[model samples]
Target: MNKLIAWIVFLSLALGGCATKVSTSFDRQADFSRYKTFCWLQGCEFTFTGPSYMNDSAVVNNLKNAIIKEMAEKGFTYDDQSPDLLLDFHVTVENRQTNVYRFEEDRFLQLDPIDQSDVYYFLEGTLIMDIADRETGQMIWRSSASRYLELNPEMTERNLRKGIGIVLKKFPPKER
Candidate 1:
């Protein structure tokens, strides 16, 4: 069991390694022509998809802080009571099952204690959404970003924030 668990962790860590590479295109695309002045409603909601967050294991503060900083610089104000734009996040963690078995002495052998181990994969992204005046409160404008995260708790927050920042940089939309 221990070995199997360890291997699972190892593989997850290997595949979920931090994203060291960086790209700085957020600002270049954050320009608005069709619409300029903006405001968030007074009572909007913020949320994320499952498996999109790191455990509260020390790096959460840094990750949250980075998001707040970048959003502010982009002219997005923080309003818990009211917000014109609703910030929502969607994430998915896939742990598809995989197994191996052997037969010996007319009996079958299981792969490991963790027989149904799986390959873990995840994606995290956020949407800055606004509801249109009519047409079922449709979307007005949105900015988003997403990326695979590393298994390391220490690396998760930073990578997630960076991903979010890059995605949101295109908010307000510019002619490209």
Candidate 2:
């Protein structure tokens, strides 16, 4: 019973640590209200840095759709010809490993124990979104969301949507 409880606690901690993390920063002086329409920045729509598998078109489209949805929710329209704000996004994936040690009690001898160590490897992905003023060409707002990568296509799409939602939640920062 004690071992079962310990395992449950360990699993909870491990999974909780893998949750998505998001951070954002913006120019407080910038007039966010003036930004009405937005379009992808020239040569900066899809910036990716990672393995070939991580650069799939499906993933890119998923990200683009998610961003568009978020912007629309904020009453922003898409205007490619002449936009008030330029949008850019970047995706990066990196290898990461975690080491875990497991100890087991010897059934026959309680005094002796067995120690087992294991190293688990995974991919960590980060999504960065940048919003810049079209006329000034200066960044106005930026946000990034990071989490462990999943190989499954469905899971990947879900993660991207969730990450984008969380990062863009602070968009059009409340006037202070």
Candidate 3:
């Protein structure tokens, strides 16, 4: 009996711990998938067309390098005037509120004890990236990644890279 119980407990724990840590809300791969391939262009080096409110030089440099690496890996070349896609980016940090509650039931209702917390929000500095058509100068593609923003620099950078990669996975739409 003791051995059987131990075996069951061990199996239960192992099974539970093996679960995935990824979010269960949306099939991340399928979300906004309809817009995966916005336009077909290549090797378009993006410029820092936006501003970074963080004022952290290290962070900025890190972002630039990460983006360049990612773009290069995707075989996208960068040019100033005749480039297939005009690349530009920015970084922003904003202060925002999370959850708010009221002590309505208690006598504290009169006192109005509302608690607030301070958190750093990191959005993909460039709220929008306009991928223009070299021939017509038309905005062929527009991408946006809005996030609560991570506080740690490394975390922030990682999040930015991941967000961009995920968004661009479906770029250069394939013709059916």
Candidate 4:
């Protein structure tokens, strides 16, 4: 039974780690089908905090390439001048402290609460992608992906691409 309990705990944590938290929102009245072209807004730059790697030019370029590929796969052409949709990217980092608790239970069905509270501080990064109507200059769609940053350069780049893909998958929001 102890082995079973251990396996259950391991599987639970493994599955939880595989889950990617993604969210998206859009203007309901916006006609997404009409958006066929995109361009980066003038003076666009990624905003970030924490380590330099988080805002490294190479890293930023890699992220942009990933986004461009995803957009093209979605049937949008990149137009330098005169585009239907304008795209913007922003990265925000925050230090988050979370407290985790552990409990002890007795065999007699009694529960004992101990002050086993553990506090963890981690850099939480958010990637925000905004799409707006080029002519009206009004945001029509937005997608955001957030994750704790703590990995090697290669893994970080991989995760960045994965995060962007997950966020953009909800593009052209489904009809009601």
Which structure among the candidates has the greatest TM-score?
Answer: 2
Candidate 3 lDDT, 7-118, residue by residue in tens: 4544564455433222112223322223212222434442343444444665555565666556666766544444445544444445443322333334343645346222
How many clashes does the backbone of model 2 have? 0
**How much lDDT does candidate 4 score?**
0.70
lDDT of 4 by residue, 1-176 (tens): 33344345445644564455677888999988888988886634433333565567777777777777888988999887678998887877677665544444442134343565455555666778888998899999888887665434353456667877878988978777
Most lDDT-accurate candidate: 2
Candidate 1 or 3, higher lDDT?
3
Badly placed stretches (over 4 Å) of model 2 are 1-13, 43-51, 106-115, 151-158
Query: Which regions of candidate 4 are displaced past 4 Å?
Result: 1-18, 43-52, 99-121, 149-157
User: Each model's TM-score?
Assistant: 0.45, 0.80, 0.50, 0.72
**Residue pairs with backbone atoms closer than 3 Å in model 2 (clashes):** none
Q: Candidates sorted by lDDT, descending order?
A: 2, 4, 3, 1
Worst 10 residues of 1 by lDDT: 127-136
What Cα-based lDDT does every candidate model obtain? 0.44, 0.75, 0.45, 0.70
Which candidate, 2 or 4, would have the higher TM-score against the true structure?
2
Indicate the TM-score of model 1: 0.45
Q: What tens-digit string does per-residue lDDT give for candidate 1 at 75-127?
A: 76655543444444333444433333222322324423334434444433232
